[model samples]
Target chain A: MSDPADPEAAPLSATHPDQPRDFVAPGADRDFAGERLTVDPAGARALLDARLIAAHAAGDTARLVTLYAEAGDSSEAAGDAAAAAFYRTHAYVFALQSGDSRAEELHRWLLREGREE
Target chain B: MTVTDSDLAAVSAPVEQARGLPNACYTDPAHFAREADAVFFASWAGLAFAADAPEPGDVKPVRFLGQPLLLARDREGVLRVFLNVCRHRGMILVEEAARLPRAIRCPYHSWCYELDGRLRTTPHVGGPGTNRHAAIDRAQLGLVEVRSHVWMGVVWVNLDGKAPEFETYAADLRARWAAFDRPLAFAPDGAFELEVACNWKLAVENYCESYHLPWVHPGLNSYSRLEDHYNIEAPGTHSGQGTRAYRPMLAEDGRRFPVIAGLDAQWEEGAEYVALYPNVLLGVHKDHAFAILLCPQGPERTVERIAIGYFDTAVLGEDWAPMRARNAAMWKEVFEEDIFVVEGMQKGRHAGGFDGGRFSPVMDSPTHCFHAWVAERLRQPA
Candidate 1:
């Protein structure tokens, strides 16, 4: 199955059209203005997944809410509807688990947007 | 009771005429306890740097004013301050300084707390009639939170729970450094910590003026002249000295660290050493940054932790150990020269006749400002 959420599937820079772009790991130092830089998709995804898994294993709903929200944003930005939906569900569950009103509102917004589509 | 204008005027008068707070203020254990309540506990005190606990779940345990404090970043990446005691059986939660944990577990009872200070487990304390124990109100029992704020990478905590808002207390510093916010990074090479055998305030006083630089730090005085130094007095709150000559620790090719986005090349010629109210001292130069946190251990003892962080993380990848070593050497030379003066002042405070030694009305404004702040806080009703 071709995953649209693959980081390599998208151009490094959407805003900077003229810049020659490249991907660099988190700790690498490259000229930000001269080149388009995209974080390694697998590594970024792994970080998000690991944080969520750890939070879930630890029963840390607050952490899960934050990680799921970040993952959902990345997935949506990459145009991966399925992955985005999955992350949104986790965000909703973690939001309810945390009893955070702001997270609850975010969950509602995600659901409303999903229903509208 | 509020301190009157006359009271302030009296305290701010030339140190000689002012009749400094009794010798007890610096020596007596009873007075130190009072200060814990009046100053360290009541007002905002700088605790640790934000960089120490940058990521979510990062935690740093600190001891300040005889209280164990846990500085942690929550799962949401929000920095939170809590007493380092477990809710169950009152054991110290974290003993080391490092990144955040999956849970803060008590060593004695294995009771766990979430990074946000929520009680997550009581560990087999719930069975039969114990499931709803009246003695343990889980809802009301979370980590005791201390009001905390971050500015310029320094974390300031209000222990009394009644301090004025952080914005209000640090308004002066925020306004002063508002321009160079983006490019400012803690220079890992320039940062340092020291243990001074004197009251923390004495260290602040020594740093607030350049009167001793010529005689004490002759190496620094070679390029940074005493006359080129200026006093930064944020009346009754914070004070420090500024210097004009700030040389960057350059790489092998003479390349300097990346400057902040909008700063001019002349920033090196415009260095500022700001003492953030109680303890933190920051030296912001165009090429690098250095900060020190002076923690008071006792009336006669203090530990000053200094860190020289850089604006560019890329510098760490370079053969920059030499730069770190040189910067540390230079600061060590300068601070070592300060020991005598601080220790001298501590010992002088014990004299029966030395009623707050004289201050040079011209060059001592910064020290006067610090004295004024100490006097003001000391006079406030506890």
Candidate 2:
């Protein structure tokens, strides 16, 4: 398996190889400019936790989809199937609600992992 | 039922011979419980206004008749009703009025549901972070939807789901008022509520006739006299009084609200107010209309909510604010004046010797009409 915390680890569709592979990379702690920050993966997750709270408080469903999906990808790269499924479930729900097209991708990922029916 | 069979027989008698509902029907909790099941649950009852959940994603939780119910407008803008309890642990879902950008997330366990009541996900039903479980069938568990129908801004619910469709049930009332069925624009400031210490039925009885107008609403009687009104009774459906002397409120600048287009000559100077049995009271005029939803808080308390709307959408503009405020205030004062009478009647119910009083055959037919309707509903086989 690839290094879980490596910035170039596989894309979120690695579990379902038939899907698009140009998606955002899992476990990649990068800033908004696509520059990899030197922050530890745990530190990066804590930052996401704060961002998630702000996003929810603002009722920003679009941002919620992106953040939860990124959290799921990071968990997936770490081989934490349960955590990955949990975050992906949220991503799927928010995406479905906001009419975001990414819901299709998140649902397929959850289905491939045997987490969603 | 706390009401005696003999008491109901007198209430069900002809208008000339009938007496009002028994005192126990209003003063006894056990009778209120029976009335809740027979009159409210078994028939279509007004629960809230569609305006309460006007936007898509708007959710309003209502505690009605001891049942926690939720009113939600789905993503498609269709309003729906559900038992507010969660399908998992029976927790209350939406605790207050809110506009959800996405799904309804249960605060206790993070169970998510789509805006249309589909159970979307259970966060960790199978153990730490695992969502799926063989025992939890998402398909079998959506919010319990109550049968609801929206008409003329009022959201009517059939709690027991045994009543006929709203259109069929209200056909007589609908056909009678078909002329004013054009687009109705709600007044931006024409909503107010009053809490009175009286049984909900008293409010309905009071609103049914013009007989009390000269004494209770002298201001309204100054222009719309009692002689200018006539009885409106559709027996098992609705009953009230219609005034042939309705005059619209005028602004300080002599401007009056725009008249409804294509009205018949009869409505040019006329208006009608009817108690839509069970809980909704409505009044329609040439230029404006109002709906009053009577919410029974307890056997001895009721909440009366009133909202007015206009025939022209221009009334919703900022320039119309002052005129709208004046209109709302006029109705508010008249409704407030009736508070003493209803509360007085409620106190009268505790008089152990009062035999429900007698109806003035000429002037009290509308009130008697309502009493007969209640009696017939209660007499239905349980």
Candidate 1 regions exceeding 4 Å error are A1-117, B1-9, B14-22, B98-101, B128-137, B183-191, B264-268
Q: Could you give candidate 1's per-residue lDDT for residues B83-103 as a string of tens digits? A: 999877788888887664356
The most accurate candidate by DockQ is 2
> Estimated TM-score per prediction?
0.71, 0.89
lDDT tens digits by residue: candidate 2, B1-382: 3787789999989878888998999989998999999999998999998889889999999999999999999989999999998898999998989988778878677678888899988866887556789999999898889999988888999999989998888899999999877667776489899999999999999999889999999987678899999989988879999999999889999999889777899999999999999899999999889999999989999999999988898989998899999999999999999999999999999998898999989999999999999999999988
How many residue pairs in model 1 have overlapping backbones? 20
Docking category for candidate 1? Answer: incorrect
- lDDT tens readout by residue for model 2, A1-117: 233467565554343332322333454456445776687767777877887898899978777777787777778668787787788888777776666677777777777767776
Clashing pairs in 2: none
Candidate 2, residue A76: Cα displacement in angstroms equals 2.0
Predicted chain B of candidate 2, TM-score versus the true chain B: 0.98
- Evaluated on chain B only, what is the TM-score of candidate 1? 0.89
| Chain B TM-scores of the candidates | 0.89, 0.98
